[model samples]
Target: MSLLFAPFKLREVTFRNRIVVSPMCQYSSVEGMATDWHLVHLGSRAVGGAGLVITEAAAVSPEGRISAADLGIWNEAQAERLRPITDFIKAQGAVAGIQLAHAGRKAATEAPWRGGQPLGPERGWLTLAPSAIAFAPGYECPREMTEADLDQVSVQFAEAAARACRAGFEVVEIHMAHGYLLHQFLSPLANHRRDGWGGDLEHRLRFPLRVARAVRAAFPSHLPVFVRISATDWVEGGWDLPQSIRLARALEAEGCDLIVASSGGAVPDARIPAGPGFQTPFASAMRQEAGIKTGALGLITDPAQAEQILATGLADMVVMARELLRDPYWPLRAARALGADVQWPVQYQRAKLG
Candidate 1:
């Protein structure tokens, strides 16, 4: 049997296959509540046969949102709204997952369709980070976080994890990638502080590790916790693969089940050799050096390519973003392409040609 269609067990949970629905922000929510649109968008992917379906980056607090429209789990009402979505995903035989995130300096931006610019006081709110810095020229500069603020953010992550468990999510992925809050703390380029939360690699990683440990304490041991990290900043003197390996090892010791390896978030101008499976090397290296399981993301589009990734032990799982968006049934098609027998939704079975 192809590894792609084989069962993948992490902690007490087992995925039916290696295909995971990567979290892609929809930028469509009201006060952080998952709407009907979220249901259909995520549910259809589950019905289409993904083994694991992860929700987009969900803010741990309202202020942590990347955009005003980002989904959140800061309150019970938001949790309640997500319950049905999780139930629907499980009903379709997929494990429901959520990516817990805090955008930090990147928060309070308009949706991509609405110019993807920072929000001002009249529209955007103040952003927070390890240090006061804008991601790039013309971007809004964020305020440096105080020790009290750091403590509060950790508590918020713990609370969000508890809420996600209550909402019936099986896997909780901490979004430390994509130049978000955690990334802000991890990247030396963005984090310029004199305190315990910044300076050397150990200090720079302190905040994110603290948040992970707190979140682990909040969730049950059986529930798997995944931490997504930008393996490289793609810039000189920034977060890179060696540091990623160290962090992955530390995260594993702190109960992380997997490291979702990605790259290039701290510096937008840094050149990334983008192509199909551009960042798989990061996952491959982390897995080999740190002895931790990893999920590979970025531009992975074909079934054969995905299987090759798994076959070579490069990554434990293949996470596709745009490919899955283009074809929600990509996994079902992938199984067929790999000559594996995977069930199709009964309603769509009639449409399946021999």
Candidate 2:
């Protein structure tokens, strides 16, 4: 039997297979509200037979959005809009999950279609971060977050978690990866504050840990919580795999159910050796050293590659982004390619080639 088809349980949530639809931003929301585009986008993956389907990084507050169009759960109204989406995903026998995030200095950017530049008053916004620094030379400089700002952001995370539960989401993954807010704090390259949130490793990790703890506390014990981290900043004098392993262990102790191991994203100048499964080694290392469950992501495209990652125990789960976007039915196709028994939706049964 293929291990990729094997069911895995984290806390009380059980995934029917190892295939997970990694969070891919749609940039299709309106004022942070999920629209029909989100429902169709996510629900199709569930119908395609993925064991887990995670929505894109959802902002915890308005200023936390990566772009003006990113989905959010900052308010009860937004949660209500998400209710049908989660219900649809679960009805298709897939676990519905969400990645809670704050973009920090990366916030208030134009949509990917609109050049992805920083948003100004004309476009409607201001950016905030652990420190006042721009991601790149031409990027907009963000305002430094005060201690009060930090406290408010933490509360925002907790509130988001509560809303997630009410929205019928079974799992919540904290987005600490991809050079966002939490990641900015983790990287010394971005965070240069002398305060408790920026000086050393312990200090840098404090804000993220506090947010995780608060979110975990807000949700019930049975609900699983995961944290996605950029395992390596891919730059000298920046966060690396070893530090990621240590951070993973600490997060586990603080009640994180899994570490979604990804790499790069602290400095735009850092060169990442991009290729198929380029970052799996980081995930492998974290699992071995941190003694915690982890999800390996990054260029994980083929069925054999995903199976190999799980079969060898390099990681507990596999998350694919671009691949899934290319083919929403990738999971179903993978089950067939790997010779695993997975049912097709009744309507599409006649269309199954095999």
Candidate 3:
């Protein structure tokens, strides 16, 4: 039997295969609401045979959005819009997951196609961070967060997870990676605060851990909560694999079911050895060192490559983003390539060659 095609059970949810459609932001929302575009974009992956279809970083608050067009679930109205999409994914035998996120100092930027440049107050609201630091040139210097701000944002994540449950999502992945809110706190390069929320690794982990705990508490008890974290800053004196392992262990104690191991995005200057499965070692290390199940992402493209990652125990699940976008049916192709007998949608069964 192919391990890649074997069912993966976490809590009460069981995935049909190890192929997960990692969150890829569409940047097509209006007032933080997911539209028909999101439904079609996400639903197709489920139809294409991904076992777990994770939605993009759905901001926990308006200010948490990476851009004005990013998805949001801060309100019930926005949460309700996701029900149909989740229902469709469940109908297709895939688990529907949502990643609750806060972009922190990285917020209020234009979408990638729009140059991703920082916007002024006229176009975007003020951003917040652990310290008064700017992400890079042209980015606004974010206001240093107060103690009250931390409590409020933590509650926002919890509330967002609760709303996601109402939206019919089975899993909630905390977006603590990609130089976003929580990750900035994790990395010393972005977070230079001298207070309880920074100055040391434990301090830096405070808020992210609180948010993860709160989210886990708010979501359904039987459902699993995953956290996507940058395993390394890839820059010296920044967050590294060892720190990630510590964070993962603490998170598991707080009920995090899996850690999605990814790297970089703490700074633009850091050198990353980018290649096929370049970051798989981080996932491997995180799982081995932290004693947690991990999802390996970054440059995981080909079908056989994904299978190999799973079969070799490099990671528990293989997350594919750009590759899945290029071929929504990559999982189906992978299943056949691995010689795993997987069921195709009735409409597409005629196209099956395996």
Candidate 4:
């Protein structure tokens, strides 16, 4: 039996296979509302046969968006807008999920295709972070989060999780990675506060852990909650694999079901060796050391490579981003490539490969 095609269970949700569509920001929303673009983009992936399809980072607050067009789940209307998308995804035999995020210092920017620079006062809003630090040279200097801000952020995440459930998402993944709000707290390079929310690793983990606890409590008890973390900063004295393992352990205790291990984005200049499976090692370490389920991300494109990662006990799932964007039916293709018997959508069964 192909491990990549095997059913995987967490909490009460059972994926039909190990293939997951990693959340990818589309930069295609209007006032943080899901548009038809989201429906077609996410629904096609479900029809393409992914076991689970996680939506792009859905900002928890208006000012938490990475770009003007990033999706948001801060309001009931936005959550209601997503219900149809989730309904369609589930109809195609896939578990629907959403990644709740706060961009922190990285908020208020233009979309990548539109130059992706930090927006000025003409369009930008004040950003918040663990410190009054700018992400880069031309980036906005975020205001240091106060104690009240910390409590509010935690509450926002919990509210977002609850909204995700009402929107029909079966899973809610907290966006702790990619140098966003939670990651800024985790990485020393970004967070420079001397309060209980920063300083050492323990203090840095406090806010995120509290947020995790709140989100877990807000989400359904039976459904699974996942966390995506930047496993390393790739910069010395920044967040690294060892720190990630500790965080994973704490998250697991807080009822998080999986660690989607990705790396870097803490700083703009850290060198990352971008090659296939560069991040699987971090997933392996988290699973083995932290004793938690992990998903291997980053350049996981090939069927054989993905299968090897699971067969060799590296990670429980393979999270695909670019590959899935290139071919939404990648899981179906991967199933055929691995000689795993999986049902194709009846509408297209006539085109099934041998």
Per-candidate TM-scores read: 0.98, 0.97, 0.98, 0.99
Off by over 4 Å in 3: none
Task: Please identify model 1 stretches exceeding 4 Å from their true place.
Answer: none
Error of 3 at 161 (Å): 0.2
Query: What would you estimate as the lDDT of candidate 3?
Result: 0.92
**Candidate 1 lDDT over residue span 1-354, tens digit each:** 889999999888989999999999999999999999999999999998999999999999999998989999999999999999999999898999999999998888889999988787677888899999887765678889987898899999999999999999999999999899999899998999988889999999899999999999999899999999999988989999999999999998998989999887787788888988889999999999989999999999899999999999999999988889999999998998999988788888876655
**lDDT for every model?**
0.92, 0.91, 0.92, 0.94
lDDT of the structure predicted as candidate 4: 0.94
Highest-scoring model, lDDT: 4
Candidate 2 per-residue C-alpha lDDT over 1-354 given as tens digits, one digit per residue, 9 for 90 to 100: 999899999999999998888898999999889999999999999998999999999999998998989999999999999999999999999999999999988788778888887776566467788888888865678889998899999999999999999999999999999899999999999999998898989999999899989999998899899899999888999998878887998999999998888877788788989999888888899899989998889999999999999999999999888988899999888988999978888889887854
- True lDDT of residue 183, candidate 2: 95
Candidate 3 lDDT over residue span 1-354, tens digit each? 888899999999999998899999999999989999999999999999999999999999999999999999999999999999999999999999998999999999999999988876689888999999989987888999999999999999999999999999999999999999999999999999998999988999999999988998899899999999999988989899889999999998998999998889988899988999999999998888888899999999877788788888889998989989999999888888889999999888889953
